[model samples]
Target: MSDDPLPFLDGPWRLSMGLRRLEPDDWLRVDDAHDAQMRLRDRLLAERRAEVAAALPGSEAGCAETLALLLEFLPERFPERWTRDGQVMVDRRNGRRVALDGEPPLVIAGRLVQEDLCLMRKGPDGYELSAAVLCFPSHWRLAEKLGRPMAGIHAPVPAFGERLGPTVDRFMAGLDADRPVWRVNWSITETDELFLPGDRAQRAFDPAEPVGSGLFLRLERQTLRRLPQSGDILFTIHTSVRPLGDAIVRPDHAAALAARIREMPERMSRYKGFHLMGMPLLAWLDRLAAAQVRVAAPG
Candidate 1:
């Protein structure tokens, strides 16, 4: 019930007035996925309630009672924000079961489908958040906030420089202090792992040899450290690097920036062995070089 949705959509309070349209097929597919997730979530909730009930068989901790407790507890903790009742139901707009409401501190209902925590704010362009960690909780505080219990969960130590790839670091290093950089997260992988290592993978870039310009980025070195054995090779693009600069970027400039970043995956894939890890350095160089090109070009 935090009145501050500021953390989620940075800057002043404003609504996302734009209506995003989705095709019927897209809607159906999203709805199916949402439904499946909700079913599983409800099942998990029921099991938890039953477990609590069994612990206190004839006591007040019955199945229905525990659910009531959860509902009651959330509202009490959140006060006016977290109200009970069916008013706050799952959204079925795109055939997905995400939570929806128009009030401040938007209510979102999603299980930990991916790892990584990111915050996005509305801009002249649209809503943008980290594509990588958008699916997963980056830190424990966020996980707890979303009711994702991670207690007693032994997390492996993070690998070295999990923040940003070498290329990104170099980009930041090249920026002038006066440049207004926007700390934004860009999505790279669909399901984790830097590269699929073969042509058969469902990559974001074109499959043509000598990889063409695309948004995908692949690293060949030990660019990532402390990766978990069980989970996918999820990475963090890091918040430190300023992906955007002031200068009132025109649409063309924005598109150019986006395309340059997208093409990183392809160029990065060409490297082998140690060269692969350090390959991101090339990506960084490419972005900086492109920015220079844009500035020097005659309008």
Candidate 2:
């Protein structure tokens, strides 16, 4: 029923990958969406600063100065290259990338200066391209796990659903006529355990893709609750819908993406990816909870 070229049910891997990568046209469509988001954030930050300044209008106290002073006492007090203007020149490390804005730009809450900041880079078409993603770490991880990284991914945690609709709209609008659009979704589960099956963990794996062997283990509800309390890990899942050889949801594709995610006893994120692609809410949770169970007790 949907006119989308990449049907919600199937596999044109190239198209799927393209959806994740932003195209030039997409940028123009979502330009305002991104701008509005940045403006709103700048306003809030400015207001907060004003409120603090109003509270201590005459006080010369400076948090940055105090932090710098404290850092000075450390044995490895190497000079950080902060500009005279207060903008921080933090190294663009391989880990997570954060963006900051005006004034003195420094790391705040493990993110960059500008929360909604985007990056434009040269693409194969010889044109500058842009894409927006969720917050730093989440988007960073998603980008790394995918076959092709998101041209731009930002999720302003400080701002949630407020920007999701606009962000997605802009992303969709920018799709290259030669590419497929990606479907992105997120959810919060009550349980702490998360798992991505070896098969599902690898994005490129197909049914014919050599299947890994494993057995389903049952875990008690009480046991599940105790290992790690709720709110332990923030589960963020990203997927792109592609057209497969014989596209049909009846193969239980929806139920597949909803597979349970359980914390690997020894690993931070390594877990089974139950492909419960399009299942309804309640059913998906039930399967996720059931799919993931406490590791079998040692002898």
Best by TM-score: 1
| Cα-based RMSD of candidate 2 | 20.9
lDDT value, residue 214 of candidate 1: 27
Local distance difference test, candidate 2: 0.26
Q: List TM-score per model, in order.
A: 0.24, 0.23
- Per-residue lDDT tens digits for candidate 2, residues 81-198, read 2222233324222222223343432113112222222222223422121222223222233233322212333222222234343543344335343442233332222122222211
Superposition error at 54 for model 1 (Å): 21
Question: How many clashes show up per model?
Answer: 19, 48
**14-99, model 1: which lDDT tens digit per residue?**
12211122221211112123334444434533454221111111221222222332344444543433444364432223233323
Q: How far is candidate 1 from the true structure (C-alpha RMSD, Å)?
A: 17.0
TM-score of 1: 0.24
